[model samples]
Target chain A: MAGVRIALWDLPTRIVHWSLVVLIPFSWWSAENHDLERHRWSGYAILGLLVFRLIWGFVGSSTSRFASFLRGPRAVLAYARGSGDKRLGHNPMGGWSVVAMLALLVAQVGLGLFASDDDGLETGPLNHLVSYATAETLTELHELLFNVLAALIALHVATVLFYLFVRRDNLIAPMLGGSKQLDAEPAARPTMARPLRALAVAAVAFAIMAWISKGAPLAW
Target chain B: MRTRLIIGSVAAGLASVAMAQVPSVAEQVKARQAGMKSVGAAFKGLRDEMSGTPDAAAVKRHAAVLAGHSSKVGGWFGASAASAPGVTTAALPAIWTRNADFRKAASAFDVEARKTLALANAGDMAGVGGQLRALGGTCKGCHDDFKAKDD
Candidate 1:
């Protein structure tokens, strides 16, 4: 049962992961209580974090990059049939699920930008740019998209549990601690981008988010 | 005697048909929604106007709209309207069961709305802003118990 411990991911990835874990619930609570001010801030925070993650997917670390996990459909099929190569990172199928989750989250935040409540009293920061009819429609879609996001999150958890119990893999611990218990010590240390680089990416993400929160006007 | 009896029966049938043509619960719900939206828009408009050096006429118009809608807020909700089957609404069943409390909230809202309009008419923008906050509280108080959550 004992295994070698190997470094699996960078700290930025772990922070982004856990931030989502907190923000998702906070978003729900704010909306349920009709606290639109808090809800808007929550959406802005999510928007910033998602931007960071998307950028990190390109340039942060090896396992965090899309190139490392993504495979063609044929590879996914082979994985499903239990014949694909086993890697330390996400299996082929999980690669696409991660992409889907990120895509849905992005879409959800986009819709919230233009959404207006039934009475038009509460509105997103960008609601001023759209017609009332369009804002209302986006609001409906915003609610609907949240449900879709919820479903995907449920499936995501189910899969994680399946791996934890049936496959006897502990995926959660590695995510938290950034190290994995492996059968053998990895031969090469996975290279992490400099912390400065991550700070640069985060700065860029949150700056854009802050601008949008101010209604994304040219003058502002 | 036979002719008179026949005429009475026809009259009763016609009255029953007329009753059936009256507004259904769904219609009431729709009107209630429209009225509520109008009131909300008025409140938001007033707040926007009050944010700067307000045009007194604009403030008066917005305040009047709120006053008018708030006065009718009572008729917009009813025993038949709350949680009516096949009706889509944010109204909770508690609106009917807690009738006395709901009425009190509506009355408070109506009082604040009228006071706001009067202040606007007197060119008292200072008073209008604070009054609306009190008005907002009544709205929140009712919504907390009587309305379903937006989520």
Candidate 2:
């Protein structure tokens, strides 16, 4: 059957994905090189992206919503046994991977807010909210989570490559172009995501980050 | 007249010896590393004093030491110091390539260090603490750009 081309990812989702692709490496470099200012800003940017994604997951297109793809364990097991190929959005297994990645990212950035390096010169803006000991513990967790994130990113890339070459599915093109051609009937035709709503959500996320950055200095 | 000539000759010899004793690139690197270690120690001492009932005298002493070391930081990063062969140093080639930025970072550190010293002398422990953090940031800024990754 001739495939029908349909909209899959929204502009906001595409932008967030690409921005993360660039910003994650930059964040790693800044941290490794001790460019604490850039590192901190990058963390905030990631936090903002995560916040936007969380909001988008709720009010986005039908395909982008968490309810669409986050299937039960039985569905994931069925996907693992080779039964989940005709869907339009994320496959059941891929959906869980997405959730795992988002959760890990949230943990990483959340710990960073209270983290401090050994010299105490470079620290998270909200570092003052906690005791030095608490900050230090969070710092350790931040470092550890970075390693975990790195490993998970490697795995994610490898999975994408496997889908591209072995499964003959070019996930990246659809993610970039926001549309995919399917050989079978599309699972569901989702309306385009609302860019204005995305803008409003992003504004709210940025404002919260700014307020956190201002910090409670008197608490320190 | 003969005594005067002898004294002049002796002075010229001493001057030649001083010129001949100029440190090698490796020696300069080592000297700078030592200087930075001392600065770190002094900064730590000042930070420790910030805890409770700060010793104003100790604060002044440590801050003065930090300022003294900060002033010498730029001089220590000589052109050849980064390229010195057979030396195990964390100094990266960017220090030479991005000379202007490096110098700016170093000078900013010096300015912050001096400010910190003034604050310490004025018995403003809180101000000193804040300035010290800024001073350390300048150091980190330069190191991030110019120092090779140890890991």
Model 1 lDDT at residue A137: 78
lDDT of 1 by residue, B1-151 (tens): 9998999998998887876655678888888888887787677677667645678898999899989888888777866566556778888877788888888988888998899999999999899987866877778777878888766
Local error of candidate 2 at residue B52 (angstroms): 18
Off by over 4 Å in 2: A216-220, B1-130, B133-150
Off by over 4 Å in 1: A1-6, A33-40, A86-88, A114-123, A127-137, A181-189, B1-22, B44-64, B78-89, B93-100, B115-132
Candidate 1 chain A TM is 0.95
The local distance difference test score of each candidate is: 0.84, 0.81
* Real A-B contacts recovered, model 2: 0.19
**TM-scores, in order shown?**
0.77, 0.65
What C-alpha lDDT, on a 0 to 100 scale, does residue A46 get in candidate 2?
Answer: 90
